[model samples]
Target: MPAVTRERALEAAVELLGAEGVRALSHARVDERAGLPAGSTSNWFRTRRALLSGIVDWIAERERADLEPGAMPTISGIDELIEGMCVMADLQTGPFAARTRARYALFLELADDPELGEPLRRQRREFERWTERIVIALGIADPVPATRALMALGDGLLLHRLTVDPELDMRPAIARAVRALAS
Candidate 1:
């Protein structure tokens, strides 16, 4: 049998997490999903924690990739920054919604686990840093609080859609938050 690539394993893990939640993410399960032998996933990720960490890394990479470059450039206004964030939120909800939802669920599951909590804390810090950078570039005098508020709002929107109504759109609400902040 051919060796399974790490990317293939991660993709399968993400799919499993999305389909059946994090409890279903085992080496055997990932191997089955990736069409590899039962131990193939273990060869790359020795433990379930390692696999979960990989999934977190994958989520971070996807989030970074979703960011708009042009919007990050230094600007003297908040409107463009908010618009860029809205665009990023839209992009996240489009092709990446499933993975995003999976990550959110996993985050909640791992929130109480000491082994995983530290990494998640670090990831949240990085996310806040990115938001801070964007807000600063947009010339906001107080970026930290605003960025945190925006992030909380974004998370709320994502969760509301995932749990309540798949058809619900949060872009307008996000836009309104932006407008309110800028006012």
Candidate 2:
């Protein structure tokens, strides 16, 4: 087998955290879960803190990909933006649920560690910048605040769906809020 890459190790760590929570994380465990040889994760991440920090950076990288030009769904108007956001919510709470859960778990897990938490802050700011552009295009008077509110609403809806109501359809509520914001 090929030598395990850092991404492979970080992906395994995220999967483990999502499936089993933060308590189950360890270099050896990540190696075992990744099907890599012993010490593979340790070779990439010398310590648990290093692993956690790597995980945060890796997750942020993945999330940031969605904001790349042309990576986002076509949104020529507020309605399309709302639909795109609902699709995003669906993805976060559906097919990509594991990663989403792992993200939130890590958010809470490393909330106090400013060193490790910086990646999360950077990711949020990047997302806000992307969203602010969309809000500006949609003609919001205060795009910055509007973008923040939109992001907060989406996060809240995602948390609700992930933690409390897996069956909840968030599109309608998202539509209403998006319209309100656009108005």
Per-residue lDDT for 1-183 in model 1, tens only?
Answer: 333378888888888887788777789999899887678788888988888988877776765554446534443566666566666566556677768777877788888886665555666787788778777766655778888888999888777766787777676787788767666
The per-prediction tally of clashing pairs is: 0, 0
Local distance difference test, candidate 2: 0.87
TM-score of 1: 0.80
Q: Among all windows of ten consecutive residues in candidate 1, which has the lowest summed lDDT?
A: 66-75
User: Against the true structure, whose TM-score is highest?
Assistant: 2
lDDT of 2 at 150: 91
C-alpha lDDT (0 to 100) for residue 8 of candidate 2: 80
Query: Model 2, 1: alpha-carbon shift in Å?
Result: 7.1
**Candidate 2 off by > 4 Å:** 1-3
* Candidate 1, superposed: residue stretches over 4 Å from native: 1-4, 64-76, 139-141
Evaluate residue 99 in candidate 2 and report its C-alpha lDDT on the 0 to 100 scale.
Answer: 89
